[model samples]
Target: MVYIIIHLHGRYFIMKQGLFHCEIGMADKLAMVVFSGTVDRLMPVGIIASGAVAMGLDVEVFLTFWGLNSFRKESLTSNTKMSRDYEDMAPMMMQLMKTKNVPSWFDTLKKAKEIGNVRIHACAMTYDLMNMKKEDLADIVDDVMAVGEFVDIAKDAKFTLFI
Candidate 1:
């Protein structure tokens, strides 16, 4: 016997015995969250990654710009420097944190990766722009990739978000 299954949005309908049956919405099956912000900026991404993993979704995180620096294998403890173009300066915040002896965003990201299935990738173009090699990146990163590579990875994803 064959069961006819129809999916609308997050709802699933199964047709049987001339009757329609529905199943509750399941969590996302796959997700690709691209992170272009600083490591500290990745806190929310980390939470999302962990939450997705908890919900049994495959999660991939693409790290670019200052975000790449958060995953260095050996030195996962660097603070991100705000770009010169940033209108609202965060240096004062950083300074205050330093005064308070708070760990940098890098450390938090490392902890998150350690506790979750977060796959981190550094952008090759940004690597070249900054004259940084893959070896220069933090240890938590899973790979260094080109934009094409990342796009290819994200191609079959069921959900994609840029943050």
Candidate 2:
């Protein structure tokens, strides 16, 4: 009983061989292109990842631009900015979350990984352009990959969002 999984053009195709040889389509994956660094925006990424994994779907996150920056070791704690539209309310929101004992966005994302498979990939070009090494990134990040590779991986995903 040999099984192979193939993802193409935003669809998953499973191939079964030997005793059975056939292709089966499935949409059990989530792919996200995280490009923002704002706290509000990043929070949703964590929630979505957690929910997707809870539903038994694999999650692949491509962190590029500001998103990659936020994943840096230093920024993980220091980056407190929120979306510009809601900039003025950041302080209040932060305080409210703290008062309510809500975990930080990064912590939420880490929690999701603990429950299921979650691969976080940094954009190779951004990683190099920013002059950062793998050590500078958080442990949650799986690796650095080019845009093409990320796109290829995302193509087979059932839901791909740019957050």
Candidate 3:
């Protein structure tokens, strides 16, 4: 009789523990993408980021090289030489973008900011040499950071991409 009681008690305890140990996928995933290039290369990333945000994914973007310039307020706002590689045509493209109301880089940025859980990080080394203050960047950018810090964040990401 004592053995029977003890066995029933043990079974109850096991079932109670199983209720608490049942799995639930409440944790969201992480995505880290490295970008370094012209708007042509980086714009597609913005589009993708917006889509990911729509799907409820957390996104962190690391912007370097000419891609970094895309986050600058002036670069987003005015018709300026965009990429050094396209010295001759950059200005023209910028103006054409402005006239079309097709949403300049600035507009795309604003949409991403409004709809997404997106964090834009500037490269710290580039920021210092470029004399760019945090305030000089677009309103959408979350912070400036080094590659090491970014990597640390990316370590547990569900997906990491380079663009």
Pairs in clash, predicted candidate 3? none
Q: Model 1 over residues 95-151: C-alpha lDDT tens digits?
A: 777799865555554555566456677787777777877677766677778888778
Per-residue error (Å), model 3, residue 108 = 1.9
Residue runs of model 3 more than 4 Å from their true location after superposition: 1-34, 79-100
Score candidate 1 by TM-score against the native.
Answer: 0.58
Overall local distance difference test of candidate 2? 0.90
lDDT per residue for candidate 2 within 1-163, as digits (tens), equals 6687776643556667733344565547899999999999999999999999899888999999999999999999888899999999999999998899988899999999999788999999999999999999999999999999999988988879999
- Structure candidate 1, residue pairs in collision: 71-138, 71-139, 72-137, 72-138, 72-139, 73-138, 73-139
C-alpha lDDT (0 to 100) for residue 89 of candidate 3: 84
Per-residue CA lDDT of model 3 for 1-163, tens digit only, reads 1111112311222223334332223224455454555665556676777777778766778877567766777776543444567768866876686697656545665687688567788988788878899888887878999989998877756788887
Question: Which 10-residue span in candidate 3 carries the lowest summed lDDT?
Answer: 1-10
The candidate that wins on lDDT is 2
Ordering by lDDT: 2, 3, 1
- Candidate 2, after superposition: displacement of residue 15 in Å? 10
- Name the lDDT value of residue 91 in candidate 1: 74
Q: Give all TM-scores, in the order shown.
A: 0.58, 0.86, 0.66
RMSD of each: 7.2, 3.8, 9.7
TM-score of candidate 3 on Cα atoms, chains taken together: 0.66
How many clashing pairs in candidate 3?
0
